[model samples]
Target: MTFLHSFEPGGVERVALRLHEAWRAQGRDARLVMGRTAGAMKREWPDLNKGGLGYEILGSERIPSSGWETLWMIIHLPRAIRRIRPDVLFCAGNSYTIVAVMMRVLLGKACPPVVAKISNDLTRSDLPAPARPFYRLWLRIQGRMLDRLVGMAPPMRAEIGTLMGADNARIAVIDDPSLAEADIQRLAAARAEARAAPQAPGRRFIAIGRLAAQKNFGLLIDAFARMAGEHDRLAIIGEGAARRALEAQIERLGLADKVRLPGHVSPLDAELAAADALVLSSEYEGVPAVVAEALAAGLPVVATRCSVSMEDMLGGGRFGLLVPVGDAAALAGAMSDIAKLKFDETAARDQSRRFTVEIASHRYLALMEDLARA
Candidate 1:
């Protein structure tokens, strides 16, 4: 059983949907369990509902669209676990992790062991002034609650382990199994389209993911405005509440003609591969799929040092350029310099191998079997 908050089209949802699909491909039974909270991802879930690899969309919406639905999901999950009786339960991201752990407290021994796939590095810095210590305590709770906590990279594992102490051993390192050959082929097509793209400017630069505060796309726009290329255009894909603020910032920067917000595009491999380089200005990440997908698609990256995983993935500034988080001038300078770089396609793809789902499955399957037995 895979427990998810909702069927949203974010990285966590995408990974959960694909994980079950991958499991089904291996002739295993996998089901996606979520609340009936409607959103953009609902459109994609139907296609993933292949014969026999069916999913359960349980319960009615109590709060419909906010963080409240996540609470409802947690409350309803224990009952669903009792009904389905899955041998091992898997929680896709941080939100679902809490739900998985809470099941034991709510439903006692009836709930199965949970395997949480950690997707973000939530530190004291993420919380408000009064909540920092509470957030730290919450991290410890998460670490103690799960049967296993999965991290995307060694750095991610080490960071979380240090934060949670001995329970850190329970944290396993696994890449986001969020891509397949189909995604790669689609990216190749996008790359081809990009190579033949119409006249633009100095170079085509792109950024992917939700347009939220965490993504720090506003920072990217600021850096882009400072960049001195009349022809250099930046495209930020994906959508969120920050669209209005971002649009206003773009206009304020006088980059209306240079930057475009095309919203969320699925299989953004081509959009990524078509660009001269992919820029990431996020405040933090849990092994961002865009960075991994871009590298796999042979796209060079210019990213802020948001997480250790980002730096570790970039070979500590060897494969691509990295700047301090929120440093607009340094980010802009790196973006300007890195666009002129000719990165080796083979090496770029090779570096991205750590995040692929195919490679991640071997580790996930063994852990699942062990947890199920225990």
Candidate 2:
């Protein structure tokens, strides 16, 4: 079983749902537990509620804030696990580690082993100086609480091992499971066809992520305003609490004509196929699914140095452009220069093979079964 706070349209929640689907397809008995059955995912993945893979909801009321949602899960998760009786518990992301620790305490030896995924960056440079030490201490606590820690990429494993103060053997490296093998193949074919066709002079850049502070989309807009050509266009895809602020920023900067906010686009491969490059201006991230998907589609990228894994992801600036976080001037320079650079489509697609869903499912099951037996 896996525990998620809600079906929010975040990468962690989406990856969890995709993994559940993959597990069920392989005849594994996978169940999901959510604190509330709310969010854009309900609309994005409507079939999720139609009963292919079974799920249990712990709360009926709508949660007003993320704090309340976490509280709701803390109050109710142990009871749900007790009733369901899953042999191994999958703690989906960082947000639920506290609840996992609580389960270990409240349920004692009755609680099943937890395999937690380190869903975000362990080195949170965005936090205030005083708060950073406390966060590091929490990471140490997580090392003690979790039965196993799964990092999405190989480079991430090193970060987890160093910061969590966990032994190398206790850490597992799995792919992000962002794309299926078939999906990658189809996108690669599309990229080839797009390459062969006559391309327009003007470039269309795409960005995918929630409209939130973490995404730093306002910075993206600011950067775009500085260097965007009259013919150049940018489309930011996804919705969140920061929508109003982003819209206001776009209008104030007179980028209303050059930039657009197309909220929550699904089947993003098609959009990637149509675009010249992908941009990510996040404050921090684990392994962003969009970057993986873009690479699978052979789309070049301009991203912030938000995570330790960025170097590996961008292949030391060979596969994509890497910029300093929160530096609008540097980002603008990179954006203006992206179309001039030539990326190796074959190499990009080959790098994407590490993140396929089939491999991730197999690795996840093998690790979980081993833990269950131990």
Candidate 3:
């Protein structure tokens, strides 16, 4: 049997890659067809030439295009599925979920079952006005066509089901299959090495993710500047169109020396392990992989209450501090509290274990098996 997987790069793509590897290891034929927008996947998984695995690119050359291009993704995707002709199709990421459901409806039973994994809570009425109609239509389509819908968190399951008008039984809550034991170990070693090396004694704060409006790193820099005297340094990883503007903000705040934008780095687990704390200033999120990784590494976290999952992930503020979105003062207060907060590595690791790749992979495999047999 063949399994076709689709996702754009970024955290979602990384999770999909792990699931693909797991499926391939199980002797199933798995092929990963990534959209051109998923540059991170193209860069990280260059070995797409291997047997039983294939990578097909779609969309425009620009990382994320606008207007007609985004809509055209729906047109191109169906053709791609017809070419692959797999027994089952697994779609990851929100964009891919919409696309997969459409394809399944168009292909009917000839296309095999389609499973769409949702990584975020979309039931909230906060979606941009212009996209709401299309978004609602897409969810309605998913309700009928999708064989199963997997959510990384329970809240997400409820949110997607409510929005799509789908049965609760059709939605399964599974942890994101990206945080593997080996990933944790590698991060631990990287942290140890960074500590043992002759690094400066400066207090470093690291934030990971694309430099987009949703990430809200601008607010993070402003908050960091308030504590500039206390913490010696700050770094925001990942890159996007907003990098230049963010750099300008750093300079305007006179924090050029204290702040650094390191672009994107691979194996961010090590970076999380080495940092004094992980600060998530996102305006929104699902179950952020970075937060889970930081918690696993025993790093204290300070994040905005962007989503219900954030509160759930942080153990209702027991694991870390939560600040209101866009409030620099609240963010500053949370950062100050981090200085006094102590984390138990064992407890943190235990919390993170709930989201391990193995557990998530098994859940996904079981769901797919059930769908295939049905």
Candidate 4:
């Protein structure tokens, strides 16, 4: 059996890499096709090459002003599919779902069973007009061709099912995976190392994600400023296009000393374990893997009610504090409450149990077995 995984950089890439390793460990022939930042991939995962995985870089050519990249992707997808000739194709990231459908259409019987992982909530009609039609078209096509649709959260499953006109029963909820027990121990040791060092003695808040508008780091910075004198420092990890704007905001808030933007942190589990609390200030999410990791470390989370998945992940405020989107005052209040908040560490760990790497891998393998038998 062969598994061909496609994903862009970010959380999807992280999850895909983990799944790839799991499949390979089980003696399945698995390869990863990366599109986006190959440089970042090398930096973040130096061991990828040593893992015996094949990679095909896409979207590298310069095109004209008419934004021919989309055309180019559609044009080149068929060739990539034919070359890979995988027994099963797993596409990660929402941006790549349409491409996966197109490839399946081009290959027909030669193509393997395609599974598109839906990682975002699509219930909201916030998508632009042009995107709505495109999404509909892709969904209509995928509904007939794709063998399975995978989602991390129930809300994501519902949204994708509704969009594709597929039965909800056809969609599978495979929660995002967590680190192995050994890796968790390593993470704990790393946290101990961070804690043992002679660092400043103030509340340390961390926001992890790209410095992009979608992450809404600007709102996080503004919220941090509201509690500027109360907390010693705030760290925003992950770099992106909005770095300069966030830097400007930090300078404007006069928080240069209090806030730091450490770019693209590898081994985030360590940093999360050391943090006083984990903050998710995104405009949207599909059951963020980082949130699960934070909870696994027993860290209190202060997040915006960014997505329906957040409601389920946080268990309606049982595990963490949830605030309204873009509301700095409410966020400041929630951040302050972290000192007095009595969170059940066992409950947090229990909630994160569903996302274990072992569980997700087995679930996916079972699904593949069923598909093969069918």
Candidate 5:
């Protein structure tokens, strides 16, 4: 059983969904248990929303506060685990790790081996100075509580191991299961055709993620306003509380004509096919699934240096451009010079193949089977 907080359109949730689908496709009896049956994913993944895909909702209704919902899950997850009695409990991401710790404590001997994924950057640099200590303490607790920890890429092994004080024996490096084989093929085809055609100076730049403060859409807007050409346009896809603020920033910058906020676009093949490049202005991230997706689409990417794995993912700026975190001037400069940046589509796609669901699912199955036997 995999534990999730909700059906929210989040990177962690998206990865969990992909893994669950891949595992089921492999004929494993995988099940998803959520704190609540709410969020945009209900519309995006209707079958899962309808409970058609082995989905179990602890709460029938939405909770206004995600904090409170997490608390509710922590209180109730132990009972659900006892009833289901899954051979293993998969904590989908950092957000659900607290629930896993609580469930383990409550169930004691009955608790199954808990496998947790480090879904975000372990460095709490985004946190305020005072909160960093608490976040570090939580990491220490997670290291002690979780039976197994998974990192998305090889570079993350050191990051997780050092922060959590776990040896290589306890940590597993798995690829981020962000793309399917089909997704890679389809996007690569579209991108090849786009690259083959005569290109224009003005580029269509796309960014995908929730409109939350963490994404720093405001910073992206400010940078775009600085370097966007007359025909260039920027589209940010996804929805969240920061929608209104982002909309206002666009308006304030007088970029209403050049910028668009298309909420929660699915099957990004068409969008990626038509775009010239993808931009990511996040404050921090794990190995952002979108970066892998964009590479699979063979699109040049401009991203903030948000993760320790960023350099590795971008091949030290060989595959894509990486700017300092929160540097609008640097980002705008990179955006302005994007057309001059050299990119090898074939190499980019090859790099991205490592992140496909097929590879990740196989590794995950092997790990789970090993755990079951142990």
Candidate 6:
């Protein structure tokens, strides 16, 4: 069973779902277990409710994305696990793993081996000084308790080794599974269902992610404001609490006409296909699914070097440029330069082989089975 919060079926949730589907396709019993069902992601993605793959809701009525969700999971999970009886409990993130480790400590032999997936820079170095100490201590405890740690990128493994005190050899590296050719075709078909928003005739730029502090979309807006007049138009896709703040920034930048907030369009992959390039202005990530999806769609990218995988994803800065996080000037310069640079779409798509579901599924199962045996 793959356990996740499932509030927003964003990249992490989507990757977990893909792995669940892949495991089922291989004639194995795999299930997606979620804590909550009522969220904006369910309405948007709706893949879970479609009911092709095996899934179960743990009777968690309250949202698990925020608040004391970890405590709730620790209280409720043992009963759910006993009922489900999965061979191994697969956690989609550190939070889930924390619950798993704590349960193992409390319940002892009653709990199953946990394989937790890591997908970000968990070192908390990017965090505020006050919070970093607490997070570090928390990670130190959780890291020691995890049975097996799976990293989506190289950075995650290193962070786990340093922070969690896990041996380098024990940390498994599996690329995030996203955007196979068939999914893109479906996204293309979805695109044909509706007309895209009108845009100025120019090099159209696309940046996707929630309007949150982590995505640092405000930096992108600032960068675009500086460079957008040179026949560049930016469309930021996604909806979040920061919508009002972003709208204010757009107005302040005088980019109301130049930038479009299309707000969470379906077939986001197809939307990426239409743009000239993808800009990832995130403060941090571990091989973001958008970066992989963008490459699969033959779209180049200009992203912050937030994760260890950014350099490899950018083809060693050949396909695109990687800049410092939250640096608007550096991002603006890279965006301008990448727009002028040209590369073949076939070549761009070729660079995304490791992120393909087929390859990643085998890697994940191999690690899961190995850990389950131990």
What are the runs in model 5 whose C-alpha is more than 4 Å off?
43-46, 49-52, 62-67, 192-201
Question: Which has the greatest lDDT?
Answer: 2
Full ranking by lDDT = 2, 5, 1, 6, 3, 4
List model 6 lDDT by residue over 252-317, tens digit each: 878888888978766676577568789999988877888877776667799998887788777777
Per-residue lDDT over 4-32 for candidate 5, one digit per residue giving the tens place of the 0 to 100 score: 88777998998998888778877888888
Question: Residues 1-374, candidate 2, lDDT per residue (tens digit)?
Answer: 98887777889888888889889889898988888777778765567747554677886655454557777887888888888899999888887789898898889999999999988888989999999999999999999889999998778988998999999989998878888889899998877777788876678899999999999999999999999888888999999899999999999999888899989877776678878889999999988989999999988999999888888988888888899999999999998888777788889988888888888998999999999999
Query: Where does candidate 2 clash, by residue pair?
Result: none
| Cα error, candidate 2, residue 354 (Å) | 1.0
lDDT tens per residue, model 1, 1-374: 98776656689888877777778788787777767646676666556455633777767655463557667777777778888888888888886766777787887888788888888876525457897777788888877777888888888777788776536558898877767756666666677676776855588889988889999999899998888587888999988999999999999888999999998776566577668888999888888888878877778899887777877888776678989888999999998899567577777666776666787766888899988877
**On residues 319-339, what C-alpha lDDT tens digit does candidate 3 reach at each position?**
889988789989988887786
lDDT of 5: 0.85
Candidate 3 lDDT (Cα, 0 to 1): 0.74
- Candidate 6: residue pairs that collide: none
Q: Tell me the TM-score of model 3.
A: 0.87
In model 1, which runs have C-alpha deviations exceeding 4 angstroms?
Answer: 42-46, 61-67, 196-199, 340-342
For each candidate, what TM-score against the reference?
0.93, 0.94, 0.87, 0.86, 0.94, 0.89
What 10-residue stretch in candidate 1 is worst by lDDT? 44-53
- Model 5, residue 143: displacement in angstroms? 0.7
